[model samples]
Target chain A: MIQKWKNHAEAYLFVTPSVILTVTLGIYPILWALRYMFYDYKGYGEAKFAGLYNIKRLFRDDYLWDAIWNTFVFASGKMILTLPVALLLAVLLNGKLRGRNLLRGIYFMPTIFSTAVMAVVFYLIFNSYNGLLNQILNMIGLPAVEWLNMQNAMLTCIIIAAWGGIGNYMLLFLAGLQGIPKDVYESAELDGATGARRFWSITIPMLGPVLNIIMMLAIMSALESYEAIMVLTGGGPSGATEVMHLYLYKLLFPVSTGETMAQDIGYGSAVAMLLALIVGVITGLYLYLSRKLNDIYS
Target chain B: MTRISGRILTWTFLLITAALLLLPIALAMLGSFKTNQELNAGSALLPKVWQLENYLYTWKEAKFSVYVWNSVIYSVGATITTVTVCSLAAYAVARRSFPGRKLLLGVYSAMMFIHMGVLTLKPAYQIMVTLGLHKSVLGLIIMMTGAGGTTFFILYAFIRSISKELDEAAMIDGASSFYIFSRIILPLCAPALGVVGLFAFRGAWNNYILPLVFTMSQPELQPITVGLANIRYGFGGAVQSHLMLTGACISMLPMLLMYILANKSFVQMNVGAIKG
Candidate 1:
């Protein structure tokens, strides 16, 4: 009994640091956000009990709704462009291709660079006036395009997002691809399965579990992304590229870009809760659907 | 003939995609060497005269010298803290089934999916402020260490995989748990620790939001990400695209080198991730 007590004590001692950090940084902040959701407060000054006032405003706020819509569009656009390309690259590179390691390294390079820094580089390249892309187009006698204009900003953001993401997902897909045993493909070949047929029948089904997890990661990441957009567009050209997180950021820490936004901590917290709910529901839904698909396959 | 054509076709597609993927980075590198005028007006891929001055100007004039140092401190500091805290907790969770272990694991898993995005940034900032550490890099380092949960899970999985006989053998010789952890388990956990360290370093280095918020009042404490953004958005009136590109290259080189050096570890880390 003494020895067991000592073991428990050691365990408690080991976990104490993590528990303190988690509670302080993770759990406490969450509760703080939850509590602040019902109060009217800025970064400074007194807190007033707003009750459901912020929630009511959240429903009516056009900008919040627009941001929510834009977030979905941006996330979906990035997903649509990223996953297939990543998977294709994974498939292409999975074989004993020449310099495949080098190729994979180059592909995954962008995932390591700072997103904000790359976005700045991208900003220069995609600049409407005298940008690298436009300069090339002009030299070839094409009309200059307003790549970051209100209409095209989201699309440009999506392309940049996709470019940054494809490599990481490709790596994920490659890992999954590797897990599908070589014999499965060999047997499929023995049964007269052609390349396309083998890929469709064997590779796709074999990758289902990995695919599900990858999709979840892709969705969460795409939705959470704002740093690139923040640097690239600042969610703008008339708030055209404003995302949910960016919206919250602007509210909480309004960048002094000649536009004075009243810092609404209460509204921002409410928006946060709603955003968390949306993410939870979507993740839950995806998990449920994936489980169903897994059942069917099994 | 079909096989030859197929090989050619595959090479063509791969090369084209690779080139497209690499174009922006290539442009940024070349643009870093070009004068502002040349970059704006000239269509040449190579600069008229390769301007080594752009880098010097960025380093000194744009205050990247300070930013780079801060970034190193932040990344290294956060990495060390995260690894230490998470590994300790991971050891406990993996080896000993103490009370509240289930609750602890459940909370962490739930936290992983919460994805509050930057919604919690304000509260986090407030917490730092309350502690009066908001202005210091140490505060940001502490706050950044909250990425512990993921690291904990990773280390937990890795530690669990380590053979139990080593611990049992050590224990039979009257080795204390701490002694076993430090001497035996830690030496064995080097690979996982390396992976976790790299990840923590990368996350901390690339982190923009927390650093941006915390260092809002303290510009000198800003990391390269925030500093680079400031050069683009906050610096003076005119856009210094050349300097920005140079700064970008400077910021990218360290991570690029690390990636090259530890390329195998990176792939191994990803594989470990999926398995976990």
Candidate 2:
């Protein structure tokens, strides 16, 4: 018993720092947040219980639906657009390309740039006036409009998100593509499943497992599109691109013209709790679906 | 046969996509060589006039030296600590047959969500205040470690791929857990560590949100990411292609070098991640 206890202490000590920080930050704060969610507390002071009022308020919120729809549309748009683009690029680059190595490094650049820096660059490039895109459009005779404003905020955000994300998924897809045994492709080709036929029959079907993970990752990131919004639009031009996570952030911070910062602390926590549950549930569903698909593939 | 045309089409498509991928970078690099006036009106493919002094101008006028130095300190400090701590924790989780292994792994998965998503702002502020970590580089470093648990999980997955025969042999020879970890396991795990370190370094260097919220108004403590963000606030109606391009190039240098050095392992490690 003593020897077993000694081993336990050693393991405990080894993982203690990470565990302590994780639990304090990871587990306890979450628990604290959950408890705080039921209260009518602002951020600076004590929290008071308000029953399910905060959650009840959540169901009637207009922006919640807007945020949810934006999140889904943004996430689905990227999954649909970026994944195939990444897959096609992965297949193209997986072949005997001369500059594959150089191209890989080039692709990784946007991914490596801090989100702040990426927002900075794209903000400049996609600016409504005198930015690169509009400037080019002027040369080709197209009138310019505010990209981050009411017209196409979510679309612009999705494009930016896809640009930042494609490199990551491209790399992941590249890894998945290369792992498909050359023998499988060779056999399929011998059976006259070359090129397009091979991709549909052999490449994609074989890449299914990896694709599942990649799709799930892309979707999860799409659901949590706060950083892009925070850095790029700040959900601006009259809340045109207000995603749920960003909305929750604004609730916590309270940046509206009239509302004080501390006024919505309790309200924000309730919203955050719901947001976490939604993100958690979506992620769980992806894992369950992917596992089922994985079993079928195997 | 369409083989010749297939090869041509492949090269053409990749080259076009590659050009699109490389646009901002190439423009940024070329802009670094142009005068302010020339940059605003210059072609995208090439600068109308070469004015390398823009590099010197921003380097001095913008105080990029301090920003770059601070970036180095935060990124390096965070990477060394995260890689060391995460690797040790991961080693224990992998090798030690503890009762809470499953629970610990679940915590690791949950860590990914809390570290960066909706909980990022509040929990970080709360922890920093409680731990007296507000506004200090080391505090930022600590939060960064927690932020990097996904990285730890990735490394753990890699470590699981190697056989346990070496550690088993070491244990038989009276090597202590720390000894076996430092000498045998850590050394063998260098390649994985490199991948982890690159990610940690890039993440630290590029992290905007944590540093944005955590650091007080001390400009001296600001990293390159924040410095670039400053450019946005002062982004008067004109295009500062020369300045933006120079900044992007400077910011990309360290990550670019690491990406080149570890490209192969990066790919291999990712393959391991998906397959597992």
Candidate 3:
């Protein structure tokens, strides 16, 4: 009995630090944010109960709505660009290609760098007047494009996002590809499925579950991404590229000179709650759809 | 002839993709060595004179040394704490049947998917301030260590895969749980711990917003990510594009080296994660 108690004590002690940190840092902040959703409080000063004013404001806020629309566009654009490319790259690389490891390393290189720093490098490359791309265009006697202007800023952001993300999704797809047994492919080949037909019929089905999960991850990450955008454009040229999180960030921590509003923690918390809801609903919907997909496969 | 053509096509396609992917990084590296004038001119792919002093300027004049030290402390501190806390928690959940075990597991799994992103940044900083830790690197490390649920789950799966016979045998020899855990299990868990440590270090090292928000008041506490952004956005007049690229290269080197050294483990870790 004493030993049993001691064992329990030992287990509890082991989990204690994690529990404390999670509650203080993870769970507590969430609750605080949730609570602050209904209150009017900045980073400083006394809190005042604003009831549903923040929520009402959120419903009517044009900037927040624009940000939401932009986020959807950005996320969808990134998804469309990244997923197919990643899948194709994974398919190409998963074979017994020579120097495939080196190829994989090169492809996955972008995933490891700081997005902020890379976005700056990209800024230098994509700068309109004297940027690398424009300079090359001028040299080639082609018209120089304004890559970071209002018209092209979102596309530029999406392109940068796709570049950073393709490697990660490719890795996920590679893992899935590796799991499909060699004999399965051989059997398919014996049955006369060849090339693209073999891939469509066998490989796609085999990768369904991983593909679903990767899609969900990719979408969630795309929606949540702001660091690259923040660095590249600071949500740019007229808030044309402002996504949901970047909007919230600007609300919470407004830059001094940009076209940001005064810090509005109350409204920002409301935005945070709304953003969380948006993410949650989309994730839940994706999970449900993926479940339906798995059922069909099974 | 068809097979030869197909193989050639595949190689051509792959080489093209690889070059396109590498172009930005290659440009950054080469551009970092060029004079500001040449870089702005943007005509030359190769630097006429390799301005090696760009690195020196970034390190000293841009105050990257301070940022690098802070990042080292933050990453190392977070990695150690995350590894320790997660390993202990994982061991408990994996080996022992305890009160709230199901609840703990449920919360952790939920937390893994519930990425609040920067939603919690404000309140997290507030909590740090309340604890009088907001201004310090230790505070940032502590807050960073909070989101280790994924690490815990990974380690839990790993520890569960480890045999229980070792624990039973250790118990039969009158070994305490802590002793078995420390002396026996920990050494065995070295690989999982190493993977987790690498991930924890990377996450902390590359983390932007949390450190950005928390260290806003204290410039000295800013990590490399924040420092790099500052040089881009907050630098008074002329954007030091060359110095910024140099800093970007400097910031990337450690992670690049780590990835090179542990290439297999880095690849395998993601594979294992997705499989789980």
Q: Best-fitting candidate, measured by DockQ? A: 1
lDDT of 3 by residue, B1-276 (tens): 998999898888788878888899998899888888888877568999999999998899889999999999999999999999999999998999987999998888777676666767777777777889888778889988844566887888899999999999999999988899999999999998888888888889998888888887789999999898888875768877788789888888899999999987777666666765
The whole-model lDDT of each prediction reads 0.88, 0.74, 0.86
Q: Could you give candidate 1's per-residue lDDT for residues A168-266 as a string of tens digits?
A: 899999999999999888887889987788889988988988998899988888888899999889989999999998887888778633447878888
Ordered list by TM-score, greatest first: 1, 3, 2
The per-model DockQ list reads 0.77, 0.47, 0.69
lDDT for each residue of candidate 2 in B1-276, tens digit (9 for 90 to 100): 599998888778777866776766565566667666664553554666677777786778877888898889988998888887788788888888788988988868766655235455576677777778777888877777743366678768767877899989988998888898899888888888877777678778888766765553677788888777667656566556568767766787777777677777656554555554
lDDT of 3 at A271: 88
Residue lDDT tens for model 3, A1-298: 9978887888999999999888877788678778888999876789899999898999899989999999999999999998888888899998878899999999888888889879988998999979988987888899999999999999999999988988888899999999899998888879988789978988999888788788888878898999999989988889889999998888888853265488888878888888988998998999998898788878
TM-score of 3: 0.97
Q: After superposition, how far is residue B65 of candidate 2 from its true place, in Å?
A: 2.6
Clashing pairs in 2: none
Return whichever of 1 and 3 wins on lDDT.
1
Per-residue CA lDDT of model 1 for B158-243, tens digit only, reads 99999999999999999999999999989999999999889899989999888888887788999998899888885788778898
Q: Residue B215 error for model 3, in Å?
A: 1.4
Index of the highest-TM-score prediction: 1
Native-referenced Cα lDDT, model 1: 0.88
Complex DockQ, candidate 2: 0.47
**Model 1: which docking level applies?**
medium
Query: Mind giving the per-residue lDDT tens digits that candidate 2 earns over A234-296?
Result: 776677777888777667655321233344766777777777778788878988988887789
